[model samples]
Target: MKKNIYSLLKGKFLTSNGASQNWVMIFYLLTLAIVTIGSSHSADQKVHEIAKLNNEVKELRSIMIDGRGQLMKLKKESYLEKKMGEKGIAISEIPPHKIKVKSQKE
Candidate 1:
C-alpha cells in the first residue's frame, strides 16, 4: 500500500502501460467540468439579462405613469379653462338649457 501511495503521489500511474483507462477517465472528467462551467456561465448570463429587462420594464412603467399623469393634468377642466383664457377664449356666461320638441306623427 505504501508503494502504491508513493507511485500515485509521484504520478507514475499516468505514465504506466495500463494507464489508458485512467487517461480516458481523466479526459471524461475534464469534459464534464468544461460543460458544467459553460452551462453555469449560460445560466448566469440569462439571469443578468432577466434582471436588466426587469429594470427596463420598471423604467418604462414609471415613464408611462408620468405620461399618464401629465395627460390627465392637461385634460382637466380647470387646466383647459386657464389655457383657453390665455388664448382670449372665454366661457359662456349662460348655462345651457335643453329643448324638447313633440312629434306630430303620433
Candidate 2:
C-alpha cells in the first residue's frame, strides 16, 4: 500500500504546486486575522456603549431622585398656596353650598 501511494505521488509534487500553497495559506491566515480583529473591535465598541448607557442611567436616576424631592415639596397644599400668593394671587374664605337634585325615574 505504501509503495502504491508513493508511485501515485511520484513526480506530482516536483513542481511549483507547493509554492502556491504558501500564498493560499497566507490568504487563509489573513482572512482569519481580519475576522478576529473585526469581532474584537465590535466587542470593544459594545463595552464602551454599555458603559456609556450605564452612566446615562446613573444620571437619569439622580435626576429622578431630585425630581422626586421636588415633587414631594410641591405636593404640599401649603407650599402651593404660598407659591401662588407670591405670584400675585389672593384667596378668600367662603361658605359651602348644598345642591338638591331630582331623579328622572318616577
Candidate 3:
C-alpha cells in the first residue's frame, strides 16, 4: 500500500502499463469539470437576464399607469368642455331628445 501511494504521488501511474485506464479517468474528470463550469456560467447569465427583464416590466408598468392617468384626465367632461370652448364650440342649454323608430319585418 505504501509503495502504491508512493508511486501514485510520483506520477508513475501515468507511465505504467495500466496507464491507459488512468488517462481515460483523468480525461473524463476534466470534461466533467469543464461542463460544470460552463453550466454555472450559463445559470448566472440567465439570472442576470431575468433581473433585467423584471426591471423593464416594472418600467413599462409605470409608463402604462401614467399614460392611463393622462387619458382619464383628458376624457373627463370638464376637460373636454374646456378644449371645445377653446375651439369656439359651446354646449347648448336645450335638452336632447332620442327618436324611436319601429322596425317592420317583411
Error of 3 at 11 (Å): 1.7
**Model 1 per-residue lDDT tens digits across residues 1-98:** 99999999999999999999999999999999999999999999999999999999999999999999999999999999999999999899999999
Candidates' lDDT values, in order? 0.98, 0.86, 0.97
Q: Write the per-residue lDDT of candidate 3 for residues 1-106, one digit (tens) a residue.
A: 9999998899998998999999999999999999999999999999999999999999999999999999999999999999999999989899899998878973
Q: Which candidate model has the greater lDDT, 2 or 3?
A: 3
Q: Which one wins on TM-score?
A: 3
User: Candidate 3: lDDT of 19?
Assistant: 95
Q: Which stretches of candidate 1 lie over 4 Å from their true place?
A: 94-106
Worst 10 residues of 3 by lDDT: 97-106
TM-score per prediction, in order, is: 0.82, 0.67, 0.86
Q: Please give the RMSD of candidate 2 to the true structure.
A: 7.8
Clash number for candidate 3: 0
Give the winner by lDDT.
Answer: 1
- Stretches of candidate 3 off by over 4 Å are 1-9, 104-106
Off by over 4 Å in 2: 1-17, 87-100
